[model samples]
Target: MSSTATTTEAAPTVELSTLPLRGGEKKAEEKAEEYKYAHLLPHFSEDRYPPLEPYKHIDPGHRALKHANPRAFLDSAERVVELTPHLGTDVKGINLANLDSDGRDQLALEVARRGLMVFRDQRDFIDRGPEFYKKWGQHFGRLHVHPTSGHPKGYPEIHLVYRDGNTSFNFEVDDSITTTVWHSDVSYELQPPGLTTFFLLASPPTGGDTLFTSQVSALKKLSPQFVAFLKTLKAIHSGVEQAEFSRAGRRGGIVRRDPVEHVHPVVRKHPVTGEEALYVNRQFTRRIVGLKREESEAILRLLYDHIDKSADNQARVKWEPNTIVLWDNRVTAHSANVDFRHLPDARHGARITPQAERPQPALEGLDLSA
Candidate 1:
C-alpha cells in the first residue's frame, strides 16, 4: 500500500459546450464508457476545477447566522471546550484561515450551535493550499461536488476521504475499517450540505476517531408524541448507494450526478438554527416516505436506533497531524472510526461541503393527533 510518482498525466478533458451534460460530465470521449478504470479518477488538462456544469443548486442562506458577533465570536476564541451538552466545540484560538468577516459570521453561529467544530494546530491552516480548501469552503455555501468522493487534483472542490478507500480501485489486504454507517453529507442532494469541512491529511498512532451524533440531540430524545410523529414524516434520501458504489467500481469511479432521490423532512429544519433535526440517516436514508413497507422498515429501524443510540448526543473526534473539523451538515451525523484503518494506518482526509438549502419542514401544518 504505497506509491508516489507524480507525472503521468492525461485523461481529464472537458472542452465545454454544455447544453445538457452529466453522464460523468460528458465527453471524456463522449461519456467514455462511464470511466471503467480510467486511471481511477484521473481527469486532467491543467484542470482549474473542471467537471461541474449542471446547475440549479441553491444554498443562499445563513447570512452569517444573522449578523454574527456573539461577543466578537467569544472574543475570537482562544479556548472554548464543550465537547458535548449536545455536540462538540473545542476551539482554542481561532485561525480557521484567519476568519474575520465578523469572524465568518461568528463562524456560522458557532457551527449552528455546536453541531461539532474542533480545530487544533491545522499546520497553519493546511499550509494554505488547495485554494485555501476551496477558499474556506466558499465562505459557507455552494462547494459540494461529491458524487462518489475523490478529489485534490485541480480541486474538484476538495472532497476525498480515503483510508486506502478506492486507492486506485480497492487497494487490498483490507483488514477492516467502517464503524457502521451514519451520514448527512449527500443527503441525496437537492442541495444537502451546510457548512462541512474536515481536513486532516494522514493520521494514525491511535484508534482513528470521528463519530458525531446529535441530530439536535436526536430530536430531544424523542417523544413530544414521537416528535409529532417525526414532523409529519418524509424521508427517502438516496444517491442509490452512490450509484451502486460508483457502478460497483467502489468509491472512486464516480457518476457525479446521476443517482439522486431527495425526499427529506423526517424532521429536518435547521437552515441555520431553526433547529429540529433527526433527518434519518443510516447512510442516505432510504425509506419512510409514506410508510408501509413494513411501515418503512419499522420506522427506519426506530429512527436508526434513535440516532445510533444517542450516547448522550455523541462526539469523538480525536484526530491529529494538523487537525481540523467543522461539521454541521445541517445538524450532525458522521461516522468513521476506521478502527485505525486495519492498522494499514493511513486515514487521510479532505472534505469541503457547503450546499445547504432545500430541506426544511419542522412542522408545516402542525396539530398532530397527539
Candidate 2:
C-alpha cells in the first residue's frame, strides 16, 4: 500500500483563550500577523464562537435524486443567463429565500451540473441575516463549520469572506494581477464542501469580482490516455496552509484547529451529474501518491495550467451588493479578484458551505479487482 508522507515538524502551540476574535482588540507584537486580513465585520461581530467537534457528515440527499428537472427550477426565474458556456449561470428575478423544497432540490441538481449559479438583488436573503443564511445551507446538507476562518461572533456556520486595503493580502503588481490561488473550499476535509452558497454583503463599484473555472471542462480537455493514467492516481489534500492562517491569526485571533489531510482521486465523479472533474487544486492538493516529488510536480503543474488557461469555459462574476452565488465545490475552482484592494472600501460576504459525500472515483467500467 503506497501513500504520501505527512508533515512531521512541530507547530507552535497557541491557546484558544488567547485568540482574539477581531483586529484592534489586542496584538502580541507590533508586527503580529493575526491582526491582518479580516472576514468578520466589526458591527456584526461577537467575542468568541466555539470550535466544531471532530465529526463527519454523511449525506445522500440531492445527489441521489433521479427526477430533478433544471427547467422547472428556472420556471420562476425572470431571467436566466449563463455567465459562461460551461461555468456560471445567473438567474434573476428570484428570491432564494422563498424557494420551496422541490425547487431547492432541483436547484441543487442544477448547481451540480452548472458548476455555479448566480442570483442578483437578493434583498430578501440579505435581510434575513446570518442565521437565515445558515439555515438555507442546512437545507442542502450538513452545514460545515470552517476549520480556521473568522465568522460573526456567534455564527460558526457562516464563514466570513472579506477584503480591505488595510489587510496585507493586497498585491503590488505592474500587471494588475500577481497571483491567482485557485481552489475548492476545504478540499482537505474527509468530506469536502459540496454545495456552497456565498452571499455578497458589499463590493467596490469597479472591482472585487470572483473568477470560477470548470474542473469538468479541465478534465475533458485532457487526452484519453492522460486521463486514463490520472484515474489510477490519488492526490493528497492538506490543511497546513489553513492551519497557518489560524496560527498567524489572519482575522484577529481565530481558534486554531489542528490541520488535516485527506486523499481524493485525481479525477472525481460528480455524485449527481456523474461527470468527471479534475480534483487537484493549487491551494490544498499537496502531491500525487506513488510518484517522486519532481514527477508529481510536473504532472500537477500541467493540470493546474490547463485549468488556469481555460478562459472559454471560465466565468467572471461581478458581485453586486446583494448577490448570492451557489456553486458546486467538487466541479469548479474559484479565485477572488483583489484588484480593489487599493481602495479604502471593503469587499465583504458570508458563506455557508454544506459538506457532502466523499469524492468517488469516476471509474465505473474500469477494472474493479486490485
Candidate 3:
C-alpha cells in the first residue's frame, strides 16, 4: 500500500431552502418525512473521503485466531484448511453450484463459523452465466444492488468488478478506488449485507491478492472498558449520490431510489452467531454520533489503526481463475491488492451481496466488566 497524505478540510454545506423543487416533486414536509434523518447525512469535502486517517503501519507478527472452531460445525466429508488463525478457511471437495439441500445447510454453518471460505478450481458456476451466479447467491439470501458499480443487463444484484479491454469500469484510472483500504461491503445500507461472495472470472498471473481481517478479533483485543464505551455509541453511514455514479460512466440496472443515510451501532451483533464485533469501518462510517469533532476523529483513528495494524487477525488470499470467496460482512473487513494494474489482462470478477438484518448491539446479557 502507498502512503498519501490526506488534508482535512471543512465539509460542504447544503441548504434545502435554496434548492428549486421540480414539478410533481414531493413538498418539503413530505420529503422531510420520507428522509427523517437527512440532517445526519455526512458532507465530505470535494477532494476528501471520510475517516481521513491513513494506515500508519502494517505489522506482520500478529497471528492469534480468536474463537474459530470450524470442526465443531463441519462434518468429515468437508476438507477444511485454515488460512489463518483469526479468519479465512479454504474448503475443498465441495462444489457450491452443485450442492444438495443438506450440503447447502452444512456450507452455511461452516461459513458462519469460519467467517470466510475459499473454493478454488470451481467450474460449475463459472461456465454458467449471470443468472446461475445470481441463483447461487439467492440460496443464502436476497441479493443487494450496489449504489455505484455496474451490474450485468437484467441483473441488478450482481456487480461486475471487471477491467477487460472493452470494459468501462477500469480500476487503473482512479487512485481513489483502490481496494487496499479496509472495508465491509455496503456498510452504508440501513440493513448492510450479511454475506458477500466474489467469483474471479479472470485474474492476473500474479498480484491482486485480497486481505481479510476478523473484526471479532479486533474488538476482543481492545480493553473491556473501551468495549463497554463503544457499545454506547452509534455512527453515521451515507450512500453514494447518483451523480457520482454517472460521473464514473458505469452501466448497471439503476434502482433510481432515494439516497440513504442511517445510524448504526458501533458494536454490532452477528445475527447468526450472536457474537459481538466492532462495526465501524474506514469506508462508510462518517463519525461517532454526539461526539465532538476532535474527539470523534481521535477515537475513530485509534480503532482504524487497531484494525489495520493487527497482523495476527488477517489472512491473505491470492485470486485464482474460476475461484470463489465468500465472507461474512458482519464479522470481517477486507482489502484488495491493486498490484496488477499495469497488466494488459485486467482483473475481472463478479460480486454478490446477500441481504442482512439491521445492525443491533449485542449487549443483552453479557457482563462487560469481566
Cα deviation of 325, candidate 1, in Å = 18
Instruction: Report the C-alpha lDDT of model 3 over 1-370, residue by residue, as the tens digit.
Output: 1111111211112232311223211332244343322221211112212221212221110111222432333454357788987688986655667765445545665666678889866767666777777877776666676654545545657766644233324222254754567888767776677666777654556677778889999999999999998888888876654334534433322324445667788898876667789988786778888889999999999999999899998988866555788888888888767666565543456677876677767766423220
Give lDDT tens digits, candidate 2, residues 197-245.
8865555557666788899998888899999999988889988866675
C-alpha lDDT (0 to 100) for residue 51 of candidate 1: 40
Model 3 CA deviation exceeding 4 Å by range: 1-78, 164-179, 241-255, 364-370
Task: Kindly indicate the candidate among 1 and 3 with the higher TM-score.
Answer: 3
Cα distance off (Å), candidate 1, residue 29: 16
Q: How many residue pairs clash in each candidate?
A: 4, 2, 3
Question: Sort by TM-score, best first: what order?
Answer: 2, 3, 1
Backbone clash total, candidate 1: 4
- Candidate 2 similarity to native, TM-score: 0.82
Q: Which lDDT value does model 3 have at 183?
A: 81
RMSD of each: 18.6, 9.1, 14.0
Residue 241 of candidate 2: its Cα lDDT? 68
Off by over 4 Å in 2: 1-70, 168-177, 364-370
